[model samples]
Target: MAVLTLVLLLAGLVLGALTAGAAPDKQAIVGSALGLEGKLGAAIAKAPAGAGAGQIDSSAPRGFLGIPGAPQVNPILAFLWAVWVGWIFSTVGAFGGIMAGVGHMTIFGLGDYAKSFKKTAPELNKVLTDCIRMANQWLVGLSSAISSLNYLRSKRLAWPLGLALGAGSLFGAVVIPIMTGGKISFSQYQGWFGVAVFVVGGFLLYETTPKGQAGKKAAKAAAQAFEKSVKEGGESAQGIAVKKWGLTRIEFSFFGVEFGFNPFWAFIGGVLIAAISSFLGVGGGFLYVPYLTSIVGLPMFVVAGTSALAVLLSMVTSIASYLNFAGAAVDWALIGVELVGIFIGSMVGPRTQKYIPDIWLKRLFVVLALYVGLGYFSKGFFGQSWVPM
Candidate 1:
């Protein structure tokens, strides 16, 4: 499985570079196809007997049709593009999930450690908080330095770093459960915390953001273009609302089957999940996948495809956010290594899905949800720390 994943990834990278270079000029072709022309016209009123001289002045129409270039995208190439994109996104989602898991463990574990000390030495609570805060800052700085170093290296150091971090995180996760007497550290709780954090953080960032200021300057430009479309088209209330909210519908036919959805909504959902996950230390996919499947009423297969697309968008947003706000704390090497593993895992997932019964899958989801809910309830009500119970 690992070997297959690596091969696919290499192929995707090669294909991506080739496609980027070979993409045809859309502007020239579209312009030619439309046969658009620019002209000026004037109205003339004839006086009695003959319009000996009708005044003529420069006059311009309020509008003109302009066709932009359209890329000559071959169907086969497009399908390949979709596959490669899907693979890339799935890999990133996997990375996000692992990072969220590890990060949450670190936070929760430290919190518990603080409680244990504070319980016995009440005066040390303030000191513990200060120490944790300092440690967090130091960790951020260290991660940033490592990331810079990794970027400079010829060969990626992601694998080794990932192994170390993953091992340490897993150990912490395991120990937390055992230390808590197995009563509080349920998998469900961890998943929920991760999902909640990703969702909430994403929402806050986007909602509170001043209009047209949440993303890169290019994204703002796209928003402006969309707004212009609304104005020019004289769209209806619903159309205007959708345009204002950045809704976009996309359709594709695959293997004789038609699939379609609003990519914008899916992207927003992913971003919301990613932000919340960052805060809570869990993967955003827990919420994203469920929402895509259950709420969006998509089949499991299509849900996976759509979620992968959304995850890619979310990761882009996340990377942007981290670079702007938390770059110092992120471990790029670790992310890269985990991505390799995730890529492998994601490829395997599709095959597994083919064999798993729908009933079983649904039941599994329900069980996971129940477990997480119970864990949170216990933690909030009993004030139980997340140690191994």
Candidate 2:
């Protein structure tokens, strides 16, 4: 699977690079887009009931369409976008949405342009949001699967944990999305998401502070000891191995250290994580990593792969739900542009992670979560992000 993902990534890179060399000129784009508009307008004019802008409205996104005066994006920029998303996902098993949002915002200011666009073409915004969600979810799911292949080959993933989490994710991502049917607006989602994750981020950040020095010191010492053992030619043996898998609970050993968790609670966590992720268009790894490490008492070494597996499963179900229930329409042109780069980035993240210490990775995760979580919270609660539409 790993080899397959790598081969696909390389092939895509070569083909995309070649195609980008002959990008269309600005006049051509205007002609094509306007031509499309003409066709759509004409088709609507001939409709039996009534034909107008309301019936055939288009909220087409700029910058991504290679239109005149739009942000110019070729395979290179798209590839880099994928690489960025993949690196974040592979390293921490999440952050794909935030990176993609930042990438899209480059075309225009995030809330400012969106608010204006939605004001003019209200219904079209719903379809556009759904399409973007589908594309981003697909990217996350594929990247996570690619990253998990190597971990699976090396037996680093805890299958029991994955199964439990995946089951819950299916419920959270698929069934729940279908039930809601896009009733939640973007700002409403943002506000709720901010309030929920703010607490998690704050708690994790505090754990790294001086007041929580005991845990930090212990984690750092363990990491240093493991590094020294490896340097002295002795196997540090920091890997997860399943000891017991059962109906209600499962137990595992990490680097000769044992831990147990209730499968039911993990499943419940998976449900909550997937519910939020399906709405937010993320892989839910940020939530999963913290849950596994802090709440479940699992070592950080095993959390990446486990979280990735869970994310992959959730994305699979969530994607189906979005298309089926949310009426999402994917932008294939944009997706093709980024898939190759994301694959490369995701594949490299796990392989290179060995050089970094476990304590450092956890620290990185906490800091990112705090920063991102607070940004979401502040914007949702106090900023102008919530456009009451």
Candidate 3:
């Protein structure tokens, strides 16, 4: 089923790219439909540049879109690239997923088993569970912090950024497993890393505030005052109450599948995930996992599985957007190398999860979070160029 979905998604992207230019004014029409005006309209008015801008020519390849001046790679080559990249990402995602799952199982499942089995060493089970829970949260938080810093410093925060970051992280996750031969230690750096990430993220946020922008302090203050007033008003009284008690949720449907999202807050959560995911190079699964667990009151297991599932949707949308607009050529050989690395990493990642103690897991997560945060903060404060590859 997963394979079929991926195939269909790729096909749709190719078709969309080929036919993007069928109507020269399609983007204009779309902008008008969306009720955009002026500069916004102009921004949206541009079609996918390059080969995505030409008319469909039958004389071209059967599935080809006649994009003028577009660099066209052979279909066979593109297919191979897709396969390689897809496999690589899948492997990375799978490995992360498996490790996360094991951590969760340790926390909840093992604890349950200890009670049910009436084991002589049941107390050890509780300690292990706690460690895993802590590690999971810490790692997630660290990743989030890093992602946030990256986003704040970036001139442009787009979905492609997130995709690339995801790709990179996937590579890292897979590589670590291979280098260690599945004996990667979560204990060595989880907690400190998380602290570093948080620090970096906080610094980036501080540096990017409107106060830091030239001559914007007064305006920023005024805006904040206005917002505060609105929040304190009678109209906002009920709204605030509702916010406190209400379940904040976001629902969207794609490819005939209905997905639900919520985590303490809606807009902030969405923006954070979108921005950070783009910046950090992972599908934002780490952030989502924590949010779902801490705020939405979901089980750790559910969060891990659901986040992994959501990534597939994100990847498809990203690939489709790239194909439809940029029409970049895929490098199949390079993609193949990535895939091999990913597959090996994913298969081995889960095994490590089973061995790590829960307390240690939590500490590891914290360390990673801190590291990411610090990295971002430094970039923002120092004006360092921290571009993702």
By lDDT, who's the top model here? 2
Residue-level lDDT tens digits of model 3 in 1-389: 99999999999999999898476663222222122232222322332222232222222342211212213434454334333333322333312422332323222232232222123222222222222323232333333343445433432222222233344434433332223211212222222333435643443344345544433576678988888888543432110011122245444332233334443343345445544332222345656566656775544433444444334433333333322332222333433443344355445555665676533544444444344444434333443314320
| lDDT at position 281, candidate 1 | 34
Candidates in order have lDDT scores of 0.36, 0.62, 0.36
What is the C-alpha lDDT profile of model 2 across 1-389, one tens digit per residue? 99999999999999999889876653211112333232222322232221222222233344433211223456677788778777766775444556665455332233333223243334333444444455556666565556666666665777788888889988899876676544544444445555544555556566667766787788889989988888556777677778888878788887787888899998999999898777766667667888888898776667777887888788878887776776655547677778777778888888878988645665776765555556555554665533222
TM-score of each: 0.31, 0.61, 0.30
Ranking by TM-score: 2, 1, 3
**How far off is residue 104 in model 1, in Å?**
5.5
RMSD of each: 33.6, 18.3, 26.7
Question: Which is the better candidate, 2 or 3, if ranked by TM-score?
Answer: 2
**Angstrom error at residue 208, model 1:** 41
Q: How close is candidate 3 to the true structure, as a TM-score?
A: 0.30
Better of 1 and 3 by TM-score: 1
Whole-model lDDT, candidate 3?
Answer: 0.36
